[model samples]
Target: MSNLPPLNNETIWDIINDKIDDAMVNQLVWDCLGYSYDNSSQQWDINNVASEWREEYPEPPNFIENRPPTVKLTRSIPPENKQLLKEELGFKGYKVGEFGPRQTRRATVANWLLSYMKQKRETSDR
Candidate 1:
């Protein structure tokens, strides 16, 4: 039996969105992470380049499924933590797509769990 929970309903989504990272639901709380609803109505300022960049890049859909990353990581994950997610946590990569995107550091982490979940469910059915 795989450690990963099979994707059904919203289990996988929760894991990707809430389980792994602390997400800020509030928009008014001042912070340099995620979106701030309070700033949504700010007038466009030519001097403040940050205002422009805020709209351009957030958590890009660098992963598979063309799905936006539910976890908005602010920093690079340490190697030890990576090992935990990979070795103990049982994260796997995509079965489809280019090799670099599929196997390299940019490989989809959620896809790892999702693919394994699918495999586990398939074998269990038989």
Candidate 2:
């Protein structure tokens, strides 16, 4: 049996600060074994569970009006989007030290904006 505690709104907010939905967390708790959410600690605990099903990053990026990117090149972008960003727009920098998946809140929100901007550009171009 799992030692995961039943999650409440407060606990969920405390964990990810409302970055993802409750149902998703509940489903993860159900599907992933050797993991548990602590109500008091407001965090998830894993016991020797090696899986790509969990991580944490809540620092979202900032944005303003829809404006063309100024930089012509960049290396600070998380590896996944570096190529795509160069093709579509561009990025500034963020000292990630090395290339890897950045599942940060900033990355999450920036991803959404990038998708939205891409779609709009495609639609307008078409």
Candidate 3:
């Protein structure tokens, strides 16, 4: 009875990433699967579409299984101290254990600082 297309992995992923809000994505998926969203369960009841899809396609491999763990930025450094640290890292040659040569270290640090500042400004505008 629904006008929605059949649900598939790619279709679900596209819906989720298509610049829509989470609620809309949930509704679309529910409608496509012919399942009403259940607030009590906080999920759509498994419909025949999902059951059939599961039979046809095994679950996706855990892509993030081997991914590096995310770094948590819980603590903030003072702006002046951060600037001083950047300057020190910029001027000093690479330490004995580091990967790159002295000149490369300065250039790399400078580039990183410039990129960091640019990203900060861009994100603040949002």
Best by TM-score: 1
Residue 66 of model 3, lDDT score: 16
Report the C-alpha lDDT of model 2 over 1-126, residue by residue, as the tens digit: 243334443333332333545344333333322345567887655543334222311211111111111111122234555444335444433457632232233333343334434455678998
Candidate 3 lowest-lDDT run of ten: 66-75
Q: Tell me the deviation in Å of residue 87 in model 3.
A: 21
- Candidate 1 local lDDT, 1-126, one digit each (tens): 123343442444444343432221111111222233334655333232244335654322333332333233212233333343455445454345635422332233543444444555678999
Deviating ranges (above 4 Å) for candidate 1: 1-34, 39-75, 96-126
TM-scores for all candidates: the values are 0.28, 0.25, 0.22
Clashing residue pairs in candidate 3 (N, C-alpha, C atoms within 3 angstroms): none
Candidate 2 — which pairs collide?
A: 59-106, 60-106
TM-score for candidate 3: 0.22
Please list the C-alpha lDDT of all candidates, in the order they appear. Answer: 0.35, 0.36, 0.36
lDDT of 1: 0.35
Residue 26, model 2: lDDT of 34
Scored against the true structure, residue 44 in model 2 reaches a CA lDDT of 51
The per-residue C-alpha lDDT of model 2 at residue 14 equals: 34
Q: Which should have the higher TM-score, number 2 or number 3?
A: 2
Q: Model 3, stretches more than 4 Å misplaced?
A: 1-100
